[model samples]
Target: MKEFLCTDKDFKDIAALVYNACGIVLGEHKREMVYSRLARRVREHRLKNFSEYLAYLNSNKDKEFDAFINAITTNLTSFFREPHHFEFLKHTIVPQLLNSNKVAKRVRVWSAGCSTGEEPYSLAITLADLFPSSWDVKILATDLDSNVLAKAQAGIYTAANVNGLEDKTLKKWFLKSKDGHTYKIKPKLNKNIFFKRLNLLQDWPMQGQFDLILCRNVVIYFDKETKDTLFKRYANALNNSGYLFLGHSESMGKEHSEFKNLGKTMYQKQHNARTV
Candidate 1:
């Protein structure tokens, strides 16, 4: 491997490009992090340094750009990474939605920024455990990074990925590979999940509203204005009385008439009638 030099100018230019392309605000401090990620791309393209890489990026408008975004985007998630949210879903949210005649029997969940499938899969497992019957359940798992989306769609994981799951849950929801080194989500669990590469900053192609939207730990990277815009979009994307789960550090700013904080980074859509 050769020593790759990334100038201050190069870092700033790349950071600006990233912010303009997506809403992710990479602060000046992220220069080293950016270098660490994109350096491989720079080498893969056989470029001399970061300057040449940025030059290439400026000239291209194709898959490489997607590759660039995929390389830089952070994807840190696991099955029930935020366990309390799943608990809330299983204990309170799902039961009420399913039992209420006023609400639709069908359930729709969007795992926005679903990295490598853990969040949506956990939701699937929870629903499967709770319902256990033939129910109309659809989960749309989307991420800006196509690479992670590919991995998410595969529904496969290493043994470590299933670490904290209960034995019965593991046996019921995942099938151990013949070698016992990998586990794949059972087909039944995979059926309801629809994985797609979706940039949250871009227009959402899906038409129907979601009953639950888990955009956890995602908007923390966005600026305040971007967060406000995205939260409003989340409000619009959810059905009446739907729930929005944010990252622990993220909030809905001041109270919005459309949504009421249910605490623990959960917000309920305020319709004509409050149901939570």
Candidate 2:
């Protein structure tokens, strides 16, 4: 990879571009990462420095800008990620929703930052096993990266990616490939879950008072203001007392007063005067 130096002006422009294009506020510490990943683009385009790259990101009619957003965002994911959330969803949430209302028959769970298919597929399996006879469960999975979205929609994974799972869950959720070295989701589990290209910072186009929302391990990249706005939107999108799950390392702190913490990484929307 080619190396380029990012000056203060370069940093400012790059931060603004990332935030505007993807709602990701790149902090000062990630300056080197910007230079490192994007420097290759400069070299590939044979541009001289970060300043030139900034202009290209602004002026290019091509995907130099789109490619930058794609490169800057992280897309790490796994099955049963932050596994306690799944346990909580299965043991606590599903039953509550099941007993509550007739509309509850249609369960809409979202894997909000669903990177690949793993999280939603895991949720689908849990829903299927929970409601074996019902065909009403749905998982709305979304991500910013179209590349990962395509891979996620395909629902194929190398054996190594599925390593840290109980044998039973693996067998139920994935079909062993002909090579016996890879895994793919069976259509039964794939039916209700949907994949869409979404950016959390933008106005949400889908209306959902979803029963459950899983936004794990993605917001750590955003600045505090971005996180605050996104959480507020999430609160609005959820149903009455709808459950929200965040990453194990993340929290819904003083920033938002509408959500009450049930336990680590689990939250419930409180009774708001208008919403209730």
Local distance difference test, each candidate = 0.86, 0.81
Write model 1 residue lDDT over 1-276, tens digit each, in one string: 537999889888887878887799999888778988999999899999999988898789574899898889999888998789989998899778778623446788999999999999999988876663666788999999988999999989999999988999889989999998899999988998999888888888989988899999899889988888888888888887889999888888764667889999999988843222
Candidate 2 local lDDT, 22-121, one digit each (tens): 6776888887888777878888888888898888777883767667777787877777777788888889888887787455477788888888778888
Q: In terms of TM-score, how similar is model 2 to the real structure?
A: 0.91
Which regions of candidate 2 deviate over 4 angstroms?
272-276
**Once model 1 is optimally superposed onto the true structure by TM-score, how far is the C-alpha of residue 185 displaced, in angstroms?**
0.8
lDDT of 1 at 55: 87
